[model samples]
Target chain A: MQKRISQREIARLANVRQETVSAVLNPNSRGNTRVSAESRERILRIAAEHNYRPNLQARILRGDSGSNLIGVLINARISQFFYDLLLPLEVELRKRHRRMIIGQLGNDAAEAESVLQNFIDYNLDGVIVLHHDISDGRRLFNHYLPLLPETVFLEVPPGVSGAAAVSIDFANGVREAVAHLAAGGRRRIALCMNDLRFLSMQMRLEGYRRGLEEAGRPFDESLIFIREPRPDYTFAELISDAVDLLAVRGKADAVIAGNDEWALALLREMNRRGLPVPGKVALVGYGNILNICRSTTPELTSIHHGMEELAAKLAAALEKPGTRFPPVLSHLVVRQSSI
Target chain B: MQKRISQREIARLANVRQETVSAVLNPNSRGNTRVSAESRERILRIAAEHNYRPNLQARILRGDSGSNLIGVLINARISQFFYDLLLPLEVELRKRHRRMIIGQLGNDAAEAESVLQNFIDYNLDGVIVLHHDISDGRRLFNHYLPLLPETVFLEVPPGVSGAAAVSIDFANGVREAVAHLAAGGRRRIALCMNDLRFLSMQMRLEGYRRGLEEAGRPFDESLIFIREPRPDYTFAELISDAVDLLAVRGKADAVIAGNDEWALALLREMNRRGLPVPGKVALVGYGNILNICRSTTPELTSIHHGMEELAAKLAAALEKPGTRFPPVLSHLVVRQSSI
Candidate 1:
């Protein structure tokens, strides 16, 4: 193991006081006497040769820390989605020596604003909100836009935007799923949905629309079916009614759902009705809920949202501002159903 | 709503500048004489009334933030637990105007140490460790003790020591469950376990032994069995040999599992052999895994570890320095089996 040189050794070698060494180490001299540029460079060179990284904690204790702390707001109700994304993001942020804090917002914009205001009170460098309804989302931007301190928001639906945005690109993710079905010569595809209120739905819909338009396949509205998202909804009559509406009104050679949970439910309903998935209706569920959905008759081909990549981009956005990030693309994880 | 008074206003009112106000707000200031004590007091009083707070970003950018960041090392594997606990702690910390940074140590202690060391290098005010093993437990006091920063460890088993700890008292929790069973007239008891090596299991076992002794019942070692935890084990022969051994040697009237998953497995294993739970063997589980144990032949009587309390304590420990937390006591929620 290599021995680490101390600040004292560097000071002795440079023939400068320890205080001078400290000033150079901080990289930011607020009220302290400005050291000469040449002297600063010589001190740094000597320090580098000795591999003398000034104990950062010692500097912070002396009132200097370059590492910034940022808040990340995520409500508990949507914790399932939030945690899945956060775990990777935490790792990435820590790597760049930036600290991340967690925050939860109430359902309304007022509470969200309160939480945002609280972050401001704490003097956080920036914030990233995981769940923001359109109304609340607009309010968050309007509140923080004045400060504009590297603000970031995730999953804000297209069109309603303020702040540096990063989201799993559902458009490309869903388009690939549809393209896979199209390649397999499937027409009359159905887009199953739980709710169209979420930003994710818009992206899924965009991809679904784009795939059909490019394939020259007529978009069939009759086959589109809406169902309750609850897991227990499998036993409810609404699921059967929705399946019946899809099967009776028209034929759907493939189905794309708003998200993974609904897609799994639709697959379960289809399986119960003796539908042989790909042979009957090829399926692709968005988001990576494959661990639970893989057991279905023909495992649903799904989109991997690339949590690692999204985390990387999110970290980079926080680290090096002005570095453009194109929307993170989700890969089509080809499975049994969409084959 | 009334607008918040800026720190500038307080500074002006107190015959000082905004930076002076900032300096005054820092209660932990060792000896910065940029502002007089009289001006500091006057500014604080006015700021409190007007709800004036420091801007975190400006303070950090200007190299002056009073808020401390606490780093927590959490187990990366338990996604669900991470979501449940970390979310509430975040909210509470914000109320105290502190920030938390999270690091996940996925089964590797060395990696966890490196992550924790980085947090220290960044001059984090405090640190909390969740799910650290016995092997690395000594390092908490050994390597980290010299720094003398506020440190806390959670879920430490019996022997590991040398730092403040916050733990769920599963022993007392299980003792209460056993007492509940004793009250319901279960004299003959069998103990089955899934995670015998876990801290929870060890506490539960101690509870079982103490509960039996309190009830003046003899401890039966022959009836005790440990099995690998899984869902597949539930409906099948996950512990057939243990079941037969307990039945023939122990002749137990009631069975208590180390945790909920193991309890469910035992329940179904017995059910498959045409044995009715509670009729022949009253069964109880721990840690209420939602829905699976319920909707069974005899709904399980499960122990409820207060998630809210746990979350609250976790946050409190991060901010306030306490010798140790009171052991967590849980109530057994009776549905059918014991009741």
Candidate 2:
């Protein structure tokens, strides 16, 4: 096998200091020092002849100020909502000349730890974690909190120390969704959630109860349905049972779903039972994932959770470290399903 | 700013060789050497005291055997189908203890070049390009073909040189879907596609024509709907126009959509027009995205394009370099929409 060449070899071949070679190669070092044009050309020629490229990883190991790499940690089971958030985030990062490396965290704490470890081992300049569960956040804080000064957590519960967070105001969003339904004379309102253990879902439940009380309607525990969170759990059976309990027995006139997935499943079950949307049982979904909303018959009305704004704010926070951002509010997008 | 400590400094502090320190730090280096338990403990203690972590990326640059990092290149606008593909791919990669970094390529050629450049700069062991357009592929092949020895292109056109590819047999899949629709007493079958420039869509068109000939029906040019690809083209108006052209004018009894997105749009239009699925106009969708298929009212009948199998095959090719893989086939998944 051929021996690989390095910047040291390039400096030896060009008969210049290694720092001179680095100054010629490093884009950030260009303005600081002046290498002779002839020596620079010789270094470049030697580098080209040996097919030598600067190892960014090595530069990072040398404690170079910037690696220009950002690590993004996302949940393993990402939805269209995350993709929507990521697109704009990538655009913003690209504008700053930063490349993103994504790590997927599974439901298991150990797997999430390994993913975070990989990010650290790679020496990423900063990290952005999206939608990590509260328990996972606590575990991560306990073990790796010191490494998170340059990290930002999105949609994490408030009061997490050692890292910045940008949480969605899900409570306000759910209140707006429920109030919209109530204003339309939907007295019997139900809340459908998946895994209330998540901090965001717990906030949604609180918002649901608050909206009902504000609307002068008693909170009905029987109307709230919580199911296990799994990709394979289509919620078909769960939503069917919910329809029986709310629409058939309790005469519920409206329901607020935790996310678009549950809302779509509820819509499917309603269609199966020949129930008229908005006329008989109005429905509202969270995370206004536009494609899923528009694809359904009588386009789903959903809470617009400010995913783009969140991405923009995250980019700003990342670009200017220690820049505090306020919690973004989620608003309602009234489409055909919720009148 | 506080100076960071390296493994060499830790080795110096612990009075051990740098190689011994490496062997202690690297998980892969443990089996080959026998460091005394006391020495190992002292070295580990010193390393911990100095807060030393090995830079895996630098090791890769130094021609170390493995960094266990895979870079996946995805299109900017990824759908649920892509996520379904990625879920299994990530699982398979993780089984081998390899972490994945994803880079998104935009429509602009320059932007795609920058993304591919980032992948090369990162020193990823391998790459997988999913569903990139032909022009982008050509640009990549022109500029970065030599860097793609361990790269695999998924669902890309044939004849791309210098890289392995795992292409979906869209022709066979479309043929199976159309035959199923025709077998159900549908003679005048129409084809709806977006962007004929894509090789996959072109193959779908051929399959549509072949299925019509197989069914002893002439291919009606009026029944084929080809629309330009756009992120915002909801296909509602396009499918509405197709419905008018096929059901109202051409008297087509069935339609084959290019993918699930278009098919769902068609279903929405049919539901709005009070047309019964399969009774009045049967619909078939390609790429059986599970969530979308199950979310619909009648449940979408779609072509199962073997996303899991594709991911498995790609992982196999990546795991064993130079392994040749045959083209995978797509099959019909019968559901209520077509039957």
Candidate 3:
């Protein structure tokens, strides 16, 4: 093994004085002493040549510790559908004079848990974990958990014993979307949804049922599409069944889609058959993917799941430890697809 | 604030000793020095009542610092085109026992520059910057460059000087996509692109010209479409002249799309007009959105740029300094659409 290049060696290579190299190397060196232009250039070239790096160990030990960091672990990539939630969370955290350490989750659930544990071990001042179907819910409960730092879990239902919980109220949003379709002179209302067993989809399905019963409409079981959330599943399966239920099988007047992406898929399918949106059959979707909603002709009406609000609440839980907040309802965004 | 709750206060509140409180605080406190379980519970109960929390700042200083930590600055949202690149970077960085700190560019370009400047103040061992059009080109020439910590800029051509550079080698990727279309007996290829003024797009267009000249086809200016990069632009604006020249005027046989998403958009527009992809007209796209390519009926035959390979090289750059790596290319993932 080679002994790595030091600050002294970088100074030697740049052909500048060591003090000049140090001035550029440590941006916050005392007394605000400035380095000359020629020396600065030479020092940079030398640092590149020698690959001289600072000992962050010594620096952290001398009291400049965390730099106001909070770690957040989310299951999916920051999707357009969810940016409404995360933008405020990131911005608000910064406002409170804290920075975030974000770890994007991948396929493996174990990898997700491992990343969370690693963040905890790193001494993050607080943590906000975005919920997916985690395998370690039981594991999180097994031990008498340490009096850990302030922690917030988003998307998980409230009152998880001691932890602060925040989530978008999906049930209310679905209710509004379903009622909009049902009350607008539509009967035999069908639900185009993913599995009704998942927490979110289940709530949406429940809302659909409630909306149908109020309008004296029979809930059809065959209309539900359960794709099981696979990465490989073509959304075409969703549209094929959804359109068939409304256009062929159920003779339905309106259909509620599982999500905005799936709704867009159905609209494309309808466009293929030359079906005019809302003119022939009404449709609504969930999780408003903002830009995409606009591009589609006749645009998509969606239930906006207050992602930014959820993120803000989650961030507030981390920042202001003493405040207790409950789950909030989602808002509806109407467009040409449904109206 | 009010003398902030500490272990000493918890001991006083619980009516137990400070040593017992310390033992309760650190569950793994050196083996065999056991305090009574009842005292431990009481101490913890009092600590919770007072909202006692450990400062992670002091702890991280103890555990980390000497080891490696690399920072990455990206202009796009975690949702956008960069996921294919970032996921691999983190995976490879973890394998090399180094942690990653990510910084996202804000709405304004100047704000993003300050965000990049943050990496220097962060005391990062090294940094990988995803520099495309999102970052201002003039910032490259500015003498008051943020004192970066051994930075590497991607997609930036060589001879610009100052930092190490890595690029996707789209020179080869474009050559292959165009050559594959040209060799399939298609001539007068039309190109549909967005934001031609971007530095990266300039290189891609150059590669397109190089491919066409090699195939002995005259590059017709009339067959090219340049629209605003925003997705909200209607298909009419995007397909202007290019489609008219290809379909109406019979100027071209195949169309090379701007990127994967743009290709998909063009595919949708063509599908609406009763045009069969590749059967009636050949098409090729770049940046391989794997999920979309898989689902399209004819599927998209696309070139997969080695974002994963770039990430692994980034990780290697952080660990093994002094050598600049040439950008890597992932193979063309052939699906049903092109052939």
Worst-scoring 10-residue span by lDDT in model 1 chain A: A290-299
Residue A264 shift from truth in candidate 1, angstroms: 5.7
Query: How do the candidates rank by lDDT, highest first?
Result: 2, 1, 3
Query: What ranking of all candidate models by DockQ puts the best one first?
Result: 2, 1, 3
Q: Per-prediction DockQ, in order?
A: 0.19, 0.42, 0.12
Which candidate achieves the best lDDT against the true structure? 2
Candidate 1: CAPRI quality band: incorrect
lDDT string, candidate 3, B18-111, tens digits: 7778778854455355678888788878876765655333443454333245777664453456555666776777776656776666546766
How does the DockQ of candidate 3 come out? 0.12
Q: Candidate 3: global Cα-lDDT?
A: 0.65
Cα lDDT tens digits for candidate 3, A247-298: 6676766667778777777777876776767887787878876645654666
Candidate with the larger DockQ of 1 and 2? 2
lDDT (0-100) at residue A327 of candidate 3? 74
Worst 10 residues of 3 chain A by lDDT: A139-148
Give each model a TM-score.
0.68, 0.85, 0.71
Model 1 error, position A329 (Å): 2.9
* C-alpha lDDT of all candidate models, in order: 0.68, 0.76, 0.65
